[model samples]
Target: MFFSLIFSLCCVTAWALPQYQPQYYSFSPTVGRGHGESFASVGEGRITGVRIWEQSNSYIKGFQLKYENVWTPIYGSTSNEETELLLFEGEAIVQISGKYNPPNYIYCLRFVTSRGRSLIAGQPTGNSFNFYPVDGQSELQIVSGRSDGTGIASIGAHWALIYRNDSKALT
Candidate 1:
């Protein structure tokens, strides 16, 4: 009976646990100005991860992610790093707008997936931001202008996407 109980508990634990297969995607590199705006789209799926990268010494002040018409704000400082999320799905729009110190810093946004592979919709360039749609995914837009206040400046920007084969399927 003890052996049976142990087996049952193990089975329950396994069933309740979730499998993580991490995938990542990013927007193309572009120059951002103070108060300038950049937009990228997260394909339809479960978003289990997020990350921000500042290729240069400059930093981004603030940003936002819009999903289903809800705006989720993300703030940054002198350091560029990654941020984790529980699980988010549906269509997402990332809008990064803020001041970039040093005027010509480089930056990029990365999105990780929990299940299924990431479809790369853009590629990074040294001087320009280009979108290379995969699976017919939408293009990422990085614009320079004032959204809330005076825009900041950046040297370049890029997008990267990562996909894992072992992640659980998105429901």
Candidate 2:
């Protein structure tokens, strides 16, 4: 039983990151600082890890990834949704399937401060989009399903990233 448990854990750990690609190349226009660098993901539970860094020197302030429902993701086990993380603020969210249709779900992240206060926010972008969460800030979005909610495999979104324009900032 112990061996089996260990083996299962190892296997699970290995099957975390999504095999798909990324879908957007947008940065925060309001960010008075760095540009996003890259991401690292391993699709495990209902959520994965994405690393977004500081443009100046890749000082990662946060990352984005999907949360795998663990018990049953999509059709059975392979369907998982994306989640975003704002490390600077220590915030995260999971996409829960909504009661709507085709792809009925939303992305939300919440965290508390050392002082003690609930912080939660939803992903403004759909499966794929060119969005700016806060004006003058960096832009991050997803790109996998249609505008309405049809899923499509796009490598462009699997591991896609956009660098900051040193000469031309978003603002």
Error of 1 at 72 (Å): 17
Task: Encode model 1's per-residue lDDT on 1-171: one tens digit a residue.
Answer: 999999999999999999884334444344454434543333333233333433243333333333333434443322343333333453222332223333443333333332333422112423333333232223222222222222123423222332223443223
Model 1 ranges with Cα > 4 A deviation = 22-30, 36-126, 131-171
User: In candidate 2, what are the lDDT values of residues 1-171, reduced to their tens digit?
Assistant: 999999999989889856685444343221111112222233542222232222122111222344333221221011223233322222222121111111332232233222233333334333332223232232223322212112211111222222444442222
Worst 10 residues of 1 by lDDT: 143-152
Q: In model 2, what lDDT does residue 62 have?
A: 26
Q: Estimated TM-score per prediction?
A: 0.27, 0.17
How many pairs of residues collide in model 2? 42
Off by over 4 Å in 2: 1-40, 48-50, 57-171
